[model samples]
Target chain A: MKYIIIASLSSLILQSYLTTILKIDTIFYPLFLIVNLIVLYKYFNKDNLKFIIYALTMGFISETISSNTIFLQPILFLLISFIVIYISNRIEVGNINLFLIVPFIITIYRILSYFILNNIVHISITNQLLYQSIYSSIVINILYAYTLNYIFKFISNKYKFSMYD
Target chain B: MKKIKVNPRYLILSILIIIVVILSFISYAIKSGRQLSPVESLIKDTVLTTQKILMAPVNFVSNSFKEYQEKQDVYKKYKELQKKESLFDLQEAKLKEQQTQIEKLNELLTLEKTLSDYTYQHAQTLNRNLNYWNNEISIDKGTSNGIEVDMAVITNQGLIGKVVSVSTFTSRVRLLTSSDIHNKVSVKIKTDKEDIYGILSSYDKENNVLIIEGISSNKIIEKDSVVVTTGMGSIFPSGVLVGKVESYELDNFGLAYIVKVTPTVDYDDITHVTVLKRLK
Candidate 1:
């Protein structure tokens, strides 16, 4: 719980200030996707009530600060996060499997947001929506091979808790 | 078939989902263009205030670095500026003359309002989460600064966007590039022969251009012709630069010309903006 709070708060700060400080264009990075996947990974096979509550919290923060729309962010995060966790649990989430799972979650979320924000509400998002999803997922998936892989290795070694291949 | 198992929890969940769906529509309808409730204001003000303070040190460091970079080419830049100074003086004088002439014409025509009549407040950009793409930016000035919804946001270069929502101390400016169907700017393209009018309908993010559609005329729009707001809808003040024409094409239905415009302001690196408030 503490780690999730720290991670999300830090990510929020990063999302707010990182571009200005570093002078980087945000078109290339999938900030939301990276954070969503991190939370989803942590929630997998955990306490269901806690997971659902966290999903709601994620939705609230997004809506209050960034999205400024009601229900949509929360609803999408709840549904998608639930499915991602359920699938990962059933599939025995592996580093190899993550390449498939992460992209699927991202694409679905983008498509749904396109329908809601663009079609239903007219808060239009353009083709760059899909473009960002594709490229960001690819970049993240590659980075996961090093960072997530190392973290899992470290955890299994120190805690005697193994991650299935 | 054996009795299909039914989860009582699923029944309760389905009811809750239906209730939430209905509530969403009700809340959304109530929230549009409405004053922020105290809770909403508190949340937004706190978050935006924190972001503003945090950004201060970051901006100071960034500006210092920029100043250092600028100092390196001071001699070369000084020579360039010296040569440009006389031309700029000439242009400034010409602009002032034109401004007075326009003001006299407005009086002669008995017009109530003109573009130059608006007052502007400088605002610093803060708490902008780029994850949503080029949709919106939060500015430091808000209702307290007399900023309101639909006010025009501009930089020194040109028009950037209009304010969509405002809180007590912070407001969000929806960029011209937003895919929102209602995000249209009435623009004018003046050429040698005539003033071509069109609506800037949408932004092409991939190419970094704005598409001005519904131009019924076939008169060739020259490349790099300046586009500016006509203020026909009164949402934006007239004569604010939108962009320059890059390319044009015939629509699929063979009805109108669709001209592509390259926006003058760089949306990527926007730090400060001026929000224009029309004077009564």
Candidate 2:
């Protein structure tokens, strides 16, 4: 419940309000996707599945509500969360190796989600898939690897999972 | 031997996934022109109301910064506007005279009112869509504010899009930049010779221009020709500005001309819009 409340409030602030004020929401990457992935990576565990599920859904509610159809973001985010959990179990966080691995996972996820939405709903030309994925990957590399963590930590302590250690 | 038992957490996760998948399909299948449920409208209105509160401080600071920037050159712009204002006054008089003349002529001919007869409602954009794939946006107007689905939405610059979904206190608009095949606009390109009509079909995202395809006329079209909604489909009101023609070329078999038009509205940064509701 605590995590869901925090996640919902921050999602509204970051995804809806701040991006509009800064005017970087367009011609740039989806910031919410990167943020959700990082949050899941930092705190993935077996104890509380509801936190992970609701965190992704509430954080991504802006997408689902604004879309003509619902549940695309939750469906995509849930599938990705499961895979991230599987990966998190085997990996050690002390090595900072996720800096290298997360972007790659995100890129594949981006392409797959874009493919699904394009085929199922957006229905534009198939040619834009490659271009959009490449563009998102570059933006994600810069944003996730460097700055968003600090900006996120400023907003809430939920990302305070491993900052001190 | 110990029994191989799956953790109940995984079981819960799997069940949740299956439920969401079923919901996704149901939503997608029946997504065509359905009214929002009471729960959906309640959630949407709550978010929109909060966004309005959050945007207040942001808008204030941004406006202050803008005011400071404009203050430096205020006098220069004031002089420039003074010169233009006199010219505009003359044109305003002519326009009003022509409008009254048009009203008299229409009354004589017993013709019904048209594109000019629309009533507009102002609404502020609460938030943009979370992804770039769909150029949909949520506005602060809905059925409670007399906004309906399929009503044409526009900014001061030109036509932006049409309302797609409406709840009690919030509505969603799908911008013209959306890549959906069904998102076509009938547009009229005014040239020196005559106005040519075509369907505004695809969007050229790379170049930031809209492609108006399916024009059957071979008549030569000039560059920078004005484009507006033809109002033929009845969804969009007539004469709403769409864009200006940038260039044109023949298709592979030369059957029709594909014209590229630059949209007037910056789809990236929309703050407010007006919904044109034709009075019944």
Candidate 3:
């Protein structure tokens, strides 16, 4: 519960900073997803499917708050969340590797989704705007995700967890 | 008589799956134009309110810092003026001459009288991101106020940028000097006879210069000419100051002059700006 609060607060701060300071139009889903994933990983049993659902929910909430896209973002997040959790479970590596992999996958997913929506559906994100957005997500999302991971770890250690279990 | 066993874990998992599916269906239904549950609207409103509250302190601190810096600069300039007071008479005459020249330039361009119909709401700059691709800043105003996307934003000196996105109480603006490839601006050069058309291209930060293309070769292009918006599109008015030409060179094919410009607005010191509401 404490980690969730911290993660949400940090997400708000980063969101404001990105919009106000960077002046770039961007979404902070990767940061939100990574934080929630860390919380689920530490508290819930690795084998439980609840972890997957929670990650998906976090992704959905994050993207919805950031932009105008409605149902598409949540559905896309569910699929990506499942893939990230599955891969992380299969690998016995340290937490850092999982952190790195999640954002990279999310970034790729966002770009591919953008292409499908704008090109196939004829939604029309100009080539220049699309490239700028992808570049921002790649650079900014990685740093924000890592920071959130560490902050979540700190919060988890400070408070006992019942929500995850 | 075979013994049958049921796994408790399997039962719990099945129930969880059912709940998730039901929730998903409800979410989809709401997204597809079904009326939002009262609870959903409440949640959305709460989140937006919290975001606005969170931004307030950040805006306060940033604005204070800017004020402090401005005060320091004024103090420094004051001290320098005191030291140079012995030559004040001579400097005053030169300053008056420069002021006259500025007035003459304004007259030559037939600059409109400053509009007084709109009252400005001051906003504090929360951040400045000046990377090669994304040049932008965020301010502490949004749709809840009178700010709308695509509104022209400018400082006292010249054009700053245009509003891009508006949250409930915060907005994002894309700066004119952003190096992002998408930042194309249509501009016009004020010549002795008539205004000439051009497009703003590359931005050189090191030298604080902007490159403009599309000027015709036959036009009598000269260094130090003023460039302003042509009002070709609905984006800006016809004569908002853009920059002055710093230098020009003939292109390789001699089709157009490669004109460099120095923007009139001091982007770094901008703290407050006005958003021009289009005349109805």
DockQ of each model against the real complex? 0.30, 0.35, 0.15
Model 2 chain B weakest 10-residue run by lDDT? B26-35
Q: Which runs in model 2 stand beyond 4 Å of their true positions?
A: A1-4, A24-30, A40-45, A93-95, A125-165, B1-33, B131-134
lDDT of each: 0.71, 0.71, 0.61
lDDT of 2 by residue, B51-163 (tens): 77867887899889989999999999999999999899889999999999998999998988765568889998877764445477888888999998889999999999988
Task: State how far residue B171 of model 1 sits from its true place (Å).
Answer: 0.9
Q: List the residue pairs that clash in candidate 3.
A: A20-B138, A21-B127
Better of 2 and 3 by TM-score: 2
Residue runs of model 1 more than 4 Å from their true location after superposition: A19-45, A87-105, A122-128, A137-165, B1-36, B110-113, B128-133, B218-220, B252-255
- For candidate 2, give the lDDT of residue B185: 94
Q: Count the backbone clashes (under 3 Å) in each candidate.
A: 0, 0, 2
TM-scores of chain B, in order: 0.87, 0.86, 0.59
Q: For model 2, how big is the CA root-mean-square deviation?
A: 4.8
lDDT value, residue B154 of candidate 1: 96
Residue-by-residue lDDT tens digits, candidate 2, A29-114 = 54455445545455334444764666466534654465545555666677776676666677753226656655656665677666
How well does candidate 1 score on lDDT at residue A30? 37
Ranking by TM-score: 2, 1, 3
